[model samples]
Target: MTLYGFRIPKFAALFFWIVVWEIVGQFELMLLFPPFTEVLAAMTDVVTTPSFVEAARITAYCYLVGLSLAVVAGIGLGLLMGLVPAADKLLNMWVNIFLSAPLSALVPVIMILFGMGEPTVIVTVFMFAVWIIALDTRAGVQHVSPSLKEMAFSFGASRVQRLKIVLLSALPEILAGIRLGVIRGVKGVVIGQLLVSIIGVGALFSLYSQNFLMGHFWALILILFAFALSLAELIGRLEQKVEYYAGARG
Candidate 1:
């Protein structure tokens, strides 16, 4: 970023917001918005607590499982849709609808079907993430060069071999979609756990918020935010690394 005549580091804006937050918090503009310093202090304490660790573990488990399912199912279904026009025509409308709809509205239905357990939370995350992945993957597959398919056929490639080649060719877009889907999955897991409210990070948030522990509440949020950002950053780097595949696709 740039000021009048100088450039600022990327994180400068974040620090600026932190300062503003501190000022508002110090002045007691809102009781819920505690000072950043207090939140940091609370974070230190929270990390050392056993309950926090357990909650974090549960959340992590749900996140990993949901993300894995989303990636596999999304890729498989997207490939099917892309390769088969009839399948695409039949499912495209539903995919678009789910992608644009307010998925949180389905939480109650999920709980009813899954009975408010870890399965429900995992399913919630899957619902939140799978559609975008499927869409992106399908688009990538559709865009694969016809010449490449013809070449594979001339070489007498099997169906699985053709798919392997296509997947490699479309890796860039696949990764891009997964990156976005991962971020959405984070939001999904949080929403699911919170809505279910029986155990995990959501329960901790409820306990802290209900007791007016603003610092702890904010600390927990910061932890989740940091974790999500870290995951996104890792995937982003992977995206950059595979960018060479873009040229190869041709």
Candidate 2:
């Protein structure tokens, strides 16, 4: 693959990191960084365990629900703000504030409002994801050309028809936003469950950490990273498929 104009084999960088990790582990440089092989073995054990399966189920539930809510609400609000200048003016400030705010600080408030349960974790994921999506969707809509709207109107297109065309034109940006939001939602789920300290993958992390099971801890982390990366890559491919819509907007 080419990166920054440098050609390298697909797995070369990964192999290099694995070699470095093995060297570190062999020298006993740190108690926490286990060898690559051992970590892979631990991953096998983790995936087969009942606790891992249950934790994964819970995490997936919250992640999917939160992401679904974020996608719907973010798109709806974004369309409103984009099409209506008054709504844009009213919501833009708050959207920017939340987007820039340290959302971790709001976890306690969320817990208090929703209680220390799955709902709290789900809400946390929504909070982390919704703002970027809203902002991106709004930006995408604003970028849609005035001529397209006028053309549609001139063709006797109804309001709903105009909205459909505009949204399709914005699909690339919307997918990009959703991709980013999914990554953030992953973080939100981990943080929310960890703070609660008695549930799901977070509880497994806590258990592994307290017991100094470095292999298991890292394995769980790798699992979550793989899941997040896969989702982002899938959305990214979808964005590519819709690139024609950007030209349609013009």
Candidate 3:
């Protein structure tokens, strides 16, 4: 049969371990790890709390602002750079420096500049991600079919109209870059908050670890993982919608 008699996912492995955990827990092999049942019960409580909602709202706001600005500025600057050889040459060195640097190391410096709060976290996310998104957008523009641009020009399209019609059509690729930027920026938010935030999920994670609440701690990790997966799915759907619209137009 096919690999254990069906199309089984690797995640099925977690179910196996969870069953083993419940058995070991019943036998008192360990308590702090908690049984799968216990952790699931704790998850329902933790995920529903008002405090968790507030923390989620704060994180979402920070992520959106950071991601939105990165998209606008990244695409704008990238287009300009791709269009200008002299500009790329002049800024290439600095761009490479920031891109290569390990942004986690810059959190403290960001904190120094903006203090230990939302501003620091926002700046941290922006610094780590904007360049990569910009680089991708630039590449997308460069690789756009030259024929599409020439058609617009031959049809007497103005510069503004050409950008709006022709260049804008390439947005699905630019959006692909933005999707990556937001994901990368989210990681920065988690790290920045963990390092300096006083009242967010990071604070809760630190508090739980200190109190040795392993089950609850694992619950929080699961929540974050689920949140990230949900976001990626949402972006993937948006990409598909764009493709559908493009096809309909043709």
Candidate 4:
């Protein structure tokens, strides 16, 4: 319905920032911060490079698979905890311990246990993400309206039917936890790559940094920032869409 109001502001902001960057480069503000043009050129060059493509593939692979596993496992564990009080109490302390502990610190142990490989990286991401999701899922299941379950049961719903009809009905809240887990998982997996990757973006970053290619270094970061932002927007929109459709049922 409205188009003219949006593009102008975004274009204006882009130009303003580009002008500021060029001016900062010209003045040599501090002995650091490469020219924006250099960074942009580096970004273009990176996209064309074979190594960059490989690194991108590896990173995306680890993040997507690990995050998926985390979400599925988290939902199952959360539902079990929600339905069983004794299981919840027993798992609570262990969950809290892992949730509070520094996943980054475990990198060394993981490397020792699994050696340097993709599995280790994915596991690191899983470690950083899964507990928070599981905890949130458990809370979501517990908070599901009891009346809904009663209504389902009154219809002679079998145990499986009750779960399918009433328990899994709180998908919105559960998915919220999953979204949070995925965001954290992706970041953790990338960071884990930095710690032990031999052929991912993290490795490329290390290579450029050591060679003093500050332009390329920042260029990689810009790529990652763009990727992260785009993925976040995509998932947020999907979640909203699902919530809207599910709300109609309610």
Q: Name the lDDT value of residue 7 in candidate 1.
A: 94
Candidate 1, residue 43: the lDDT equals: 96
CA RMSD per model (angstroms) = 1.1, 1.8, 3.6, 3.8
Q: Write the per-residue lDDT of candidate 2 for residues 1-250, one digit (tens) a residue.
A: 8989999998798899999998998788999999978899999999999999999999999999999999999998888898899999999999999989999999989999999899999998999999999988998999998899899999999989999999998888889989999999999999999986368899899999999999999999999999999999999998999999999766
Best by lDDT: 2
- Candidate 4 — which residues are off by over 4 angstroms? 1-26, 30-32, 244-250
lDDT of 4 at 137: 75
Candidate 1 regions with alpha-carbon error over 4 angstroms: none
Comparing candidate 1 with candidate 2, which one achieves the higher TM-score?
1
Query: Which regions of candidate 2 are displaced past 4 Å?
Result: 1-6
Error of 4 at 194 (Å): 1.4
**lDDT by residue for model 4 (87-139), tens:** 99999889889988878888888888878899888888888888888888788
Clashing pairs in 2: none
Q: What is the C-alpha lDDT of each candidate?
A: 0.91, 0.92, 0.75, 0.79
Q: After superposition, how far is residue 146 of candidate 2 from its true place, in Å?
A: 1.0
TM-score of 2: 0.95
Across 1-250, the per-residue lDDT of candidate 3 in tens digits comes to 1586688787888888989988876686875667777777778877898888888888877777777788788888777766677877876567768878888988888889899889887787787678877777676666666677788899999999877763466566676777777778878778888986665677777877898877777788778777777777787778777764243124
How many clashes show up in model 1? 0
User: Per-residue lDDT for 22-136 in model 1, tens only?
Assistant: 9999999999999999999999998999998899899999989999999999998889899999999999999989999999999999999988789999999899999999999
Against the true structure, whose TM-score is highest?
A: 1
